[model samples]
Structures are given as C-alpha cells and as structure tokens.
Target: MSLTEDAIEKIIGKFGRYQTWILVLICVGRIPTEMQLSNVVFIIPSVNYVCLDEGAFNATNYCPCKYPEYDTSTIVSSVTSTWNLICDRNQLASLAQSMLQVGILAGSLFYGHVSDRYGRKIAVLLSLLSEVVFVAISAVVPEFWIFMVCRFLIGTAVGGTMLCCYVMIIEISGKSFRPYLPGLIELPYSISYASLAVIAYFLRDWRHLQLATSLPWLFVLFYYWLIPESPRWLITTGKRQQAIDLLTYIAKKNNRPTENIESLVIKIEEQSLKENEQRYGTYLDLFKTSKIRVYTLIMALVWMCCSHTFFGINQYIGRLQGNLYLNVILSALILIPGLILVVIGSLYLKRKLSVIISFSVAAISLLVFIIIPSNMENATLAFAFIGQLGAYTSFVQVYLYCSEIFPTMVRNSAMGFASVFARFGGFIAPFVVNIGIEWASITIFSALAFCAALLCLMLPETKDTVLLNTVAQTEKNKVVVNQEST
Candidate 1:
C-alpha cells in the first residue's frame, strides 16, 4: 500500500465520516451532470409536423413548406419545432446534440491536463461553475445557434466535472471501499436520469425543462466549500504540507489521532519523489511500455463501445413505439439492475469477467431486439431495456476498472484520454440515430459491444489489487503476472 492509503487506513479506518461525506458530496454533485447530459432526450424530442400551406397537402402528395405546423400534443415546444428542424433541416437536431459531445470531447482533453496540473478541487469547481452558466444560457437563448454554442460549452464542463469528480472519489477511498464506491456514485446518475423524465413531463416546453435541469446545479455549486483536494494528488505534486494538513483534517473528522499524520505525509512524499524521478509521468507514459500500451488501447476501445451503445440507445428513446415519457422513465429505471450488477461484480467477480459479461449481455440483448418482429412493440421494448441494462452495466464497470488499472500519477489523464474516444462515440450517436434506420443503429451497437467484450479478455483483472502510484509499479505487476502465467 502507498503511504497515503496506509495513513488513511490507520487514521480513518476506511469507510468513515470523512469518506462518507466525500462520497455523498461528489455523488450528489453528479446529479446535475447527468441531468444535463441526458436532458437532450427531452430537449429535442421528435415531433410530427405538416406544411403550413394547407393547399399543398394531400393524402398521396405533400409540399415542402418553409413554415411548418407542429403537433405539440406531447411536447409543447422544442428546438426542433422552434426552428422547424424537419425535412431537409432535420439534420440540424442531430448537429445540436453532436455539438454537446464535441464540447465534452474538447473539455475531456483540456481538463485532463488541468486536473493533473492544478488540483481536482479546482477542476471540479470550474467545471461546475461553467455548467451552471452555460446551461442557464442554453435555457434562454432565442437563437438556435446560440443555444448550440451553450450546449457545446456545457458539454465541456460536464466532461471536466465527471472526470475530476470520479478521480477525487477514487483517490480518497480505501481499498475495500474503492471498487464499491464507484458503483454507489452511479446511483445519483440513475436518480437524475429518471427524475428528468418526470421533470420534462411537467415542463413540456424545452426551455422550461432546460431551466428546471439547470437550476438544480446552482445548489451543487456550493460544493466549493465542502469538497477538498485529493490528498494523494497533493503528495504526488510535492505539496507535503498540504497533504499533511488535509490528512490531519480527515483524521480529526474520523475522530482519529492526528499525531502521526505529519510523519506519514513525509514518508509518502519521499516515496512519491523517488517514483517521480524514475519516470516523467505524462499522458505519453501510458503507451511507453507494451503492457501499458495494450491496456490503454483496449480500455479506449471498450469505453468507446460502451458510450456508443449507451448514448445511442438513449438518443433513440423518442423513436421507440411507446409513450415517450414512459419510455424515458423505464429506460432510466432499468439502470437500477445494472447498478446492482456493478455492486455485485465489485464484490464477487473479477473486473475483466464483469466487463465481458456486461458487454456480452448488451450485444446479445440488442441482437434479440433486432430479431423481434416490428409489430411486437412491447417485446422489442423489453429487449431494448435489457440491452440498455447491459450497456449501462458495462459503462459503469469500465469507469471503475479503468481507475483501478491506471496509476494515480496519470489516472485522470488516462480517463481523459479514453473519454476522448467515448465522446467521439457519443458524438456520432446522434448521427447514427438520425440515419432513421432503427435496426441499422442496433446492428452497429451490437457489433461494437461484441468487439469490446472480446478485447476485454486481453486486459488484466484488477479486482482486489492495490491502486498503483507509478508506471514502474504497474509494469512490475505486469512482470509478476507474466511470470505466473509462464
């Protein structure tokens, strides 16, 4: 165990009041992030429309009218209807959604460096602040282009907030709690996702729904005072005093003695300095060695697959043959089983096996959905839910698995690197959905899932392993595993 982990174990005894507070704060903060990410489902829902020129309409022939009449029985108003994003302009809706992913892609790359160079606290705070500002702007922007810009900005913040917050949670947690805590972190996501459906149901107007989602983030902004920088990050950055102070505070919070905190922090600093001297910890270091390179490549692929299917299914919810509101709720709620699977996997299953199982389930479920007759709407929906469950499970598992596999020095960067591809997958999801062929989209998702599962077999299982602090340690683990296999 690293000195920081040892000190935390001795001082806080693992899951304690201090860690509990951190978990709750970070997890609660994620609610708004999920809200903003998933709100697109309601913000740009599908609508039936006809040309405003009644004389041009007939049973067999239709005219392309610049002015369109929208049936707003379900959605009072949306970006689609407000701008008449239909017919030739229908691609604009997908573009708006894709813009958010583009922003997130940029943010992931930007914040990965920021989180590592600055501190997790600052990255998270800045991201949250940006999310609040941009989302509110998105709610009120009269011009579609202005709204798209806001969405892109919001996506950037979302990417930063998610990456940094997740790293902070893992850094502060103990070994026993580390794996399971990530699963718990996903609980708020499910809550926010389901709640958004209800919120959108009441507030049919996209702007009102956007405001409802954006407003709750104001409360999360208060986390500035509640959350602290990761002690491990402090130690690695050569901030011994800050690490000592933080560990002392944690010790006091957990009702443990602070007497040895300083000594522990000093020891951790020395070890970190030695490790730092051995190698320059940068994003490039991830691919410096063969084993690490293989791990990085496989992780990137799995993340992309997970995001592709997960977001594709989410974006396609409106097109499903059912009540849109109910479909959204059911889709969000189906994630509960996936979350449960994550918890169970963290405790009993190996990380590699868990990921493989989840991906396989997703692929098989999607294939079943494809085979189901088109007229059997309920059966198809059931299969879709199953597919989503598998995708959601794999998605959350990858987060935990990725964190465990990477060293602390480059953990955030590794996540950021993989997230770049994930965002790319998400960025294309709307375009895939817009293809207007449901079976074709499902085929793509299933193929990706199958490939991801197969690739996962190449990764080393990280369950119950200590989180490494340096690339050298990771390579050492690889050597031991190879020796054992031989």
Candidate 2:
C-alpha cells in the first residue's frame, strides 16, 4: 500500500546523528532572538530625575520642570534618561516595549506562509538576515521613534525565525524523539536568558548592550550554508527530486545505503498525490473542520494566556525584591527544571493532563499572591517565582503539543495564525499589568491564569499518537481505531 516499509526505515532513521547536529544548529539560531526579546528588561531605565529650571525650583521650593535632566552616575545612560520619557511621558516606555511584539505578530503570519511555500531553510535565512541588519540599526538610531521602528522590524524577524526553526526541528526528528527535542531546543533559550543578565551586568550602557546582542547574530548569518532544507517540507511542496537528494545525503551521512531511493520517491509521490487530492489548505481550513476548529480555538486561547502570563511576570521580575540582576537571572534559571520535567512528563503523562496541571499550578501561585499581604515580601517573591516556573513549563509544552495536534499541511499556518493572537496577548500584557497595578488590582492576572488552565480541559490527548499529514488522514485514523477496537 505504502512504499516498501524497509526503504522508509533506511531513509528516516530513528533520531540519528545527522538529525542531532541539525537540532543543535537550529537551537543555536534561537539564542540571540530570545536574548533580544528580553533585552528590553535591562534597557528599561532606573534613574532619579532633578528639576532643570533652577528658577522654578527656587521659587516654589519644589521640582516642577517636566523636562529635567537625570543623574547618570547610579546607572549608565538609558532610553528613559536619554529621551526624558519620565513623569508625563512615562507611558511611552511601555508602548515602546509593546511595539516589538506587534512586529512579531506580523512576522509570524508572514513567515509561516513563507516556510510552507518556499521551504523552512529559506524562511529562516531571511529572518536571520533581517535580524542582523535591524538589530545593528536599532543600536545606532539617534531618535526614539527610529529606535522603535528598528525594534519592530527586529521583532518581525525574531518571530518568524522562532516558528520556522521550531517546526523544522520537529519535522526532522522521529515521533518517539519529538517530545525530547523541544526541551533540548529550549535549553539554548534558557541559557541565553541567563546570559542576558550577565551581559547586562557588565555592559550597563544600552547602546553597548545592544551592540553585544547584535554582533552575536553574525554567526547566525552563516546558517544558509550550514542548515538543510526540511525534507518533509519539500515532499509536501512536490519537490520530490530535492527531497530525494536531501534524504540520500542524510542517509549517506548517517552511514546508511541509498538503494531504497526508489521506495522513498514512490512514498513522496503517494503523499503528494493525496495532498493534491485534498485541494490546497488555507488559513480558513483550520476553522472549517469541526474537531480541528474546536482544537484550534482552544489551543489559541491557551497560547494567548500562556504568553500573557509569561511576559507579564518577566516585566515585573526586577521589582520582586532582591538585587535586580540576580532576580532576573534567577527568574530565567528557574525555567530549566520546569522545562526538563515537562519533557519527561510528555512521555509518561497525558499531554492534556500535564498542560492542565502546569497551568493550574501557575494560576494557583498567582492566586496565593493575592491572599498574602504585599508587605510579606519573602512569601510574595516565592509565589511569583513559582508562578513563573509553571508558566514557563506550560509555554514549552504548548509548542510541543501543537506540533503534534496540527496536520503537516497546515501546521505552520495554524501556528502562525494562532501566534497572531498570542502576540496580541503579549502586546497587551504590559498594559494589563501596568494599568491593573494602578487602577484595579494585580489579582486580575490570577483570574486570567485560572481561565487559561480551565481551557486546557477541552483539548484532546495527543501523546503516543502519530502526526497526521492531512485532515482526511485524521478522520481515517479515527475510523481505523474504531474498527481495530471492535
């Protein structure tokens, strides 16, 4: 029925060395992007201002000048001090930070199409090139408006690169190995977050820090020559010759024979035929099917909640208690254990159950904070850290789970479409925290987190299930299961 089974085995070996190297390259590419996303944490200024007009201060015996200069000794210069975005202009700081997420939202939608149409490798390379140029430009922009523009462009590239790299890694690896790969991929992100703290500690000047972050991407520029185009993507796009060439190269590199090339070509052709029969999938396809539509809606809501909570916590990490640098470092470092546990649980526990537990823990931690008096600094800080651990775990698990749930044809498209909502959540998270802290209460986050956990109950368990290539396959798989059980 399918191409000879043995031939398929030889081509798509079980989590071999070649795949491992590809994984490493993709993970490394993620480092600078993650670093830049959080870089604004350090860039936000901590400074005290003094009135510039001596006459106004002298007459009133109170500081009245809104455009006062700042004391730069305690801190190296920042955008806040440099631009005088203080007092009446304070809201601009948060607005600037949110703009990056806006670009990310656009990039995700654009590049997902690029990856599905052109290929993952090209999409990733284009994103990296944009990052290198914009990141460098962002460091030198003389005005805040121009800097914001650069930040937005960089955000676009970061968003696209993140999605393409992740989907490509999952597509290359075996089903049994898929769960573990996300954890490994996340390792670089964690290390980069911690490294940002260290880097910021030494390079206090925002310009210097920006330069440091931008230069590391020079290495990422070479990925065009280093990384391979995803064979799975090529097969979907009807590039059988390209897929065969890549697969043959992979087999050779892994010391396997290519005598099975005929079978592999036949298999690719069979898949392409099925894909053509189904008609082309569009963004609307994600919503047309009832089961998939429900799953998409649920996952989309959870992704938004997870992103909102995760970035919201990051914005406040420095305000928690101890040294700002140490607090940020600990916040990033705390994710390591949570991520490892999620990876392990993806094997033994149900996917839906694990995600629900993770989100519930995060929600409960936030709720606990509302009850504990703010004066009890130690307890509040501990709960905050616990909340971060839960949010980070869920964030990583959702990515892995979505990869399994969506069919190959529309996987990136669905992810990209969903990311549009997630980025909107991120865009609003800072304002929610900032305005909520001033107007209502921070407990609002607790309620949102709880709702996110509840949404998890609606998703199906995908653990140990094969990744279906099309919606028709999913329906067929369901029927086959019913027949087998009876």
Candidate 3:
C-alpha cells in the first residue's frame, strides 16, 4: 500500500458504515440527473402528424401533408404534438436532446473549476439547486427555444452535480472500496433510467412527465445539511482545521479511536504542506510529453465515440418498432449486466484489454444488425440490445480508464476537455439520426466504435497500478520503468 493509503487506513479504516452512508448520499444525488437525461425518451414520442398545407402535397389518388398537424387522439401528447415540431420542424426534437449535451460540456468545465477553487459541497448544492429551477422552468416554457435553453441550463447544472459529488465521494472513500464504488454508483443511474419508462407511461403528457422528473430534484437541495465538504480537498486547500474536524467525525462514526487522530492530522498536514511546494500542472501539460499526448488524443476520440453512439441509440428510440415504454425500459435493463461486467473487469482483468474487448463486442453486435434480414425483427432487436449492453459497458470502462490515466492536478481539466469532445459527438448525433437513412447512421456509429477499440490497444493497462500525483512524477516513473525493463 502507498503512504496515502496506509494513512487513510489509520484515519478511517477500510469501508465502513460512514463510507457507505456517504456513498448512498452520493448515489441519491445522481438519481435526478439520470431521470432528466432519460425523460426525453417520453417527451419526444412520435405522433400522428400531417402537413399544415394539405394542398402542398396533392397526388391523383391521395395527398400526404408536408407539415402534418398531429392526430393527437391516436397517440400520446409530446413535444412534437404540443409545438407542431413534426415534418419540417421535426429536427427540433433532436435539437432539444442535443442541447443538453452542449450544456453539459460547458457546465462540466465551469463547475469542475468551481469545485476546485471553492469546495465540493458548495458546487454540488448550487448545481442541484440550479438543476431544480431549470427543470421546473422547462416544464412550463412557452416556446421551443425557451425549452431548449432551459434544457441547456439543466444540463449544465447536472454536470456540476455529477462531477462535484462523484469526485468528492471517491476522494472520501477508502482505497479498498474504490474499485467497487464506480460500478455501484452507476446502479442508481440505471435504476433511475428504467423508472423513466414507468413514469412516462403513466404521465403521457410531455409537461406532466417533465414536472414529475423535475420536481423530485427539489428534494435534493437538502443535501447541504446531510453531506459534508470533502476532507481530502480541505487538506489540499490548506484548510487544516476543517479537514481534521471532518476526518475526526468520520473516524468517530466508523467506531474508530480518536485518541490517535492528532498524529494522523499532523501527518496529513505535513504531507499537504510538502505537496503544496510543487508546481501544479495545467491541461496543456497533458500534451507536453509525446506519450501522454498520444494517450490523450486517443482517449478523447474514445469518449467522443461513446457519447455519440450512446446518445444516437437513445434518441432513436422512437424509431424502434414496438411499444416506446417497453423499448426504453428494456434498453436500460440491458445495460445492467454490462455495468456488472465492468466492475468485474476492472477488479480482475487489465483495464485496456477489458475496454478493447467490450468496444469490439459492441461494434460487432451493432454492425451485424445491418445484415440481419428485415423479416427477422426479433433477431435484430436481440442484437441491438446486445450492442447496447456492450456500448454502455465500454462507456463505463472509458470513464474509469480516463480517471486513472491523468494525474491529480489536471485530471478534471483533461476530463472536461474530453467531455467537450463527447458533447461534440452528441451535438452531431441528432443530425446523424436525421440523415434520412438509418443504415448510414448505424454504419457511422459502428465505424466509430471500431476505431475506439483500435485506440484502446495503444493505452497502457492501469489496473492495480499506483496513481501518479503529478506530471513530473508520472514522467519520472515512466523513465524508471523503461530503464528497469531494459
């Protein structure tokens, strides 16, 4: 074990009731974010639409409306029916979905910096509060543009909540619990996502569904009282007393002795002071070295592909030939096993190999669907679900892999940059789906997954490896490893 790990053991012990309570709180914070993300599945259902000018499309026997007014009686009410966003205006549905990703891109960077400069608790509370307001406003928006803007804002807030809370939980948890933490946290997302189908099925109206998802977030505001500021971050920022108090509370809650707490505090304070002497690296440092630069580029592409294909499949849920509710729920459930596999892989196998194989499996599953005969609908559906499983698993692996690749100082910045690219992919996904040819979009998605798999080949395995603290340390360790191998 490293010094920090050993120190943490003396302070908090391994995973305990205190750590479990913190994890539960963190997981609760993510529930609304997932609900908002999947709520679009219900809000944008296809309706019976007709062109505004019926005369514009005149055939000898029949005429099709170019801008069809929706036949609302036969279908559930949605953004399409409420705003006449069908036919010529149908692109707005995709725009609304994509808008959230754009907000996430900007929000992650902004909130990540805020968490670093201010504190995790502040960032998380503010984010949750903002998410509630934006989502509530979105539910009652008078215009499509306003709705899109609100979604963007909500996306931004969700980004802050996700990053701040997630990082804080990881920072505060014991080392023995680290490997299992991410996958376990992801369970809340899957559960929330699956619940969207049930809620949407009952709500039916877009506004009602929005209200249902948005209102629940209001309760999350109470987290300010329930969760505390991260002790690690406090120590790093030179808030020694605050860090000591928080750690002491954790130790007490875990039923550990507090008599030795002073010594542990002194050690942490000394280490923090010593580390503060070193220069912090910027995001640009990720590219200063050839090895890290290549890794960064490859990982960025991987992030982009994952976000692109993931959202691509999600937004196209309406196109699937079945009950929309069933499709969405089943799709979410399909990812549960994938999430479990990710935990297993991260715990047992090489990280790089796990990522590559998952990507490969996903790519093949997706590509094979194109060749499946149209008559074999069940077979095609089965393959698509299999593809979703692999894709989501790969997505989780990439997130874990990226966390390990970048060192502490600029890790969040590097992640923020990669997320921007992922949002770029999401920004393009809505348009990609509307390419008028479903197969062509599938071809592009499959190609990107294949490329991601190849890129994963070039990354070093990070499982069971010590996390480097700085760019200088990483570079020095690389040299030492090279010299020893030679």
Candidate 4:
C-alpha cells in the first residue's frame, strides 16, 4: 500500500510542475535557423560582407580578444577590400560561428549560477532579451569584425535558453509529464530550424536572412507575461512565499484551483547540511569530485557524439551528394520520427535502455552508410537521412539525462560544460564535413558512430534513480529534493 501511496504522491508531486516537453520547446524554440543559412553568404568573400562592425567576443563577457574596435566608417569599403581574400574567406564566417559558441558556452555555464543566485525569471528573461538585442545587432553590424562579436553574443544568449528552459519545464510539470516534456521542447525547435531553411530559401541575402531570423526575438518580450519564475528554485532558495505565489499562478493558468492546493501538493524532502551545499559556479567544480567528474566527462563525450553527427549532417551538403532539396527535406524529415521515438520511449521504455538503444541505432545507421557506399544509387543520401533520425532521438536523451543527473542548482552549469563540447563540435562541423568527407564520407560517419557507441557506456542509468542533488550523489540513489517549506 505504501508503494502505491508513494507512486500517487509522485504523480501529485508533478502536478503543474515544469514538464520536460515544455522545457524542450523553450530551449530550442528560437534557434536562429535563418541566420545560419543566410550567414552562409559570409563564407564567400567576393560577396563583400557589409553591416555594423562591432567587436566580437567579450565585447561584454569576462573574456579577452576585444579588438578592431567597433568602427562603421569603411565597413562596406573595408569588407570589399578583401575581395582577393575570397579563397580563405570561410575563416571569418566559421570564426564568427565559433565566437558565437563561446557566448553560448558562457551563457550555459554561468546562467545557472545567476539563476541560482537571483531567480530563473531574471536569468531566462535577461538571457532572451539580450539575445533579442544581439540578434538585431548581428543583423546590422557595420563592419565584418563587429558582426562576429554580435554573433558570439547572440550564441551566448541562446546557449542559456536550452538549459534554463529545461529546468523550468521540469520544475513546473507533474512527474509523469517530466520526461515527455523534455522531448516536447524539440518540436518547436525543429520547426524553427526547418523554418530557417524555408525562409532562407526565399530571403537569399545574409542581411535579409539575419533580419528574418533575429527579428523574432522581439517576440520574447512576451515572456514577461507568458513565463513565470521557476517554483522549484524559489522553494530551494528559501523563498517559500514566492514559491507558493508562483504555484498559485500556475494553478490559475492551468485552470486548476488553489482551493485545495495546500492538500494537493506534497512538499519535497530537503537534504542535510553536507548534502545541502549548493553548486560552486566554477571550472574546478566540474571536476571537483569523482562522480561529478565521471558524469561531466561522459557528458562531454555524449556532447561530441550528438554534435558530431548533428552538425555533421547539417554542415555537409556534399555528403548527401544528392539533390539539395532532397537533402534538406530529409534533414527536416528526421524531426517527426525523432520526436515520435522520444515520446514512445519516454512512455514505454526505461530511460537508460531508450538512450542506449537510440545511440546504438544512430551509430549503426552511420556505419551502414560506409558499407552502402556513396556511389550506390541514393545509398549515402538515404543512409545519412535515416541516420539523422537516430541522431535526433539521441539528442533528446542527452538533454533528459543531463537535466536528471545534475543538481538543480548547477544544472545550467553542467549543461554549459556539455554545451561547450557540443559547440566545439558545432564549430568544427563545417571543416570536418566539408574537408574530411572530401576524402571519404563513410569514414567520417563511421568514426562518429563508433565514438558515440563507446561513450554511451560511461554514463550510469539516470532513469528511475532519484534526480541528482549533488556531485556526490551520482553513484548512489537520487539526490533527495526537499518537499517542505523550510
């Protein structure tokens, strides 16, 4: 009877809490798909890139490399001056993407600290709002150098979006809804990504594409009304008053009543002092202890696996070596099944098995491409397309696992480390796909698949385990979250 009671409590526990699917949507909802497609123009030096020139990277963040100073005077003429440099022009565009990733890394890593210290509302709102500004600035950079800076800044903002939203959704939903919520986030993100391709198909010019993608950020201002502060964080941070108030708000929004809310909600069970220590927002902390170190390391590899194939397919059009339209359609095609598989898995399969199975399938699918050979009629193209379906499933699992494995306080930070790895893969994507595959596409896909398969071994099963409360809690049972209004 107690077992049944616990299960009931768990369901009740999840009511109105941040569900995983909603979190997934928030994370990927506004990805600048159009910007990436349009920005492809920047790779061609002869195109003569022109826009506002603002310094890239740490023109704001606490890093270095601020140079060339934001100057608009000769932006057009200066960029045109490099007409002869067209052969090597991809360096700048790739560099811009890399810089943007730096910001993403920063945002992902540090925003948790901010969210932990302040509130998720402030953290998420500030991050998205900043992206809005950066996106616009990226659209209007007067000089080539300034554009790169804005891109990096924009990356930083979007980086925070994924992790923060992940946490937010988990904190809001009921237990039964949590896993599904995480994958649900992918739907909107996929839509946004494909839309970029669709819009780029029409806009053509980088500036216009930039405008098309970045302007939507203005819509984020609506978050001020649509979103709420994370109730879990509020509860953990000793803001019971705010937590309760937020709960009331969610109940109201969901059409559920607060008349019996107190009885309906079961407070979480808080931890003891040593277990109570919050996450230290630093690089050392990621490697501070054994369990965290293991999770962090495995997550890095997982990031590599996810990013390698993810961006690999996205960056290399030649790999498809097929119809451009067909390649894109295939790329977009994977999202549907990907989301479907995630839903099916989360509802039916155990978490670990689902993840391993998905990863294994993707790896094998990738390997199949090598044996099938690109020369065969539609072999490589069809394989690449199918493999991406596996990649999408694997992708959602990473987010689900990461969110469940880290303490709520450091969720953003740990995800940040993972993001850095993923971003690094994203940064290297064009080069690996464009250059490496020139020699052999099969070899590239084969290596990536095998690596993913191997990395899946290091991660322990996070499903059904209590969600992590601290680095020390990884190998043991789930870290117990407090249920009371301390």
Choose the strongest candidate by TM-score. 1
Model 3 poorest 10 in a row by lDDT: 58-67
Give the per-residue lDDT of model 3 (tens digit) for 153-242: 988987777667776766676555656766887888789888878887777778887787777667777887888887766665667788
Please give, for residues 357-464, the per-residue lDDT of candidate 4 as tens digits. 777777777677667744695777666667777776877887887877776556667777888888776676655654634437545655665676677676665554
Give me the runs in candidate 2 sitting further than 4 Å from their true place: 1-10, 52-64, 69-74, 275-280, 436-441, 479-486
Candidate 2 clash figure, as a count: 0
Q: What are the C-alpha RMSDs, in order, of all predicted structures?
A: 2.3, 3.1, 3.2, 8.7
**Global lDDT of each candidate:** 0.82, 0.76, 0.74, 0.59
Q: What is the TM-score of each candidate against the true structure?
A: 0.95, 0.92, 0.90, 0.79
Output the worst ten-in-a-row residue range by lDDT, candidate 2.
Answer: 1-10
Clashing pairs in 1: none
lDDT tens digits by residue: candidate 1, 1-486: 342245556655667798888888777766767898788877787678766566766312133666677788888898888987877777898998889888988898888888887888999888877887788888888798898889899999999988888888888877777767757888888888888889888999988877777776687768878999988788877787888888888878888888878877777667656655642256788789877787888899888988999889888766898898899889989897778779988888777888899999999999999899999999999989998888888998899989988888888888998999999999999998887687898999999999989988888877766577777667768654444234
Residue 395, model 2: Cα distance from true site in angstroms: 0.9
Off by over 4 Å in 4: 1-85, 255-274, 277-285, 322-326, 373-377, 436-442, 465-475, 478-486
Shift in Å, residue 27, candidate 1: 2.3
User: Is candidate 2 or 4 superior in TM-score?
Assistant: 2
- Candidate 3 ranges beyond 4 A from true positions: 1-6, 56-67, 73-75, 259-262, 265-295, 466-468, 479-486
Question: How much lDDT does candidate 1 score?
Answer: 0.82
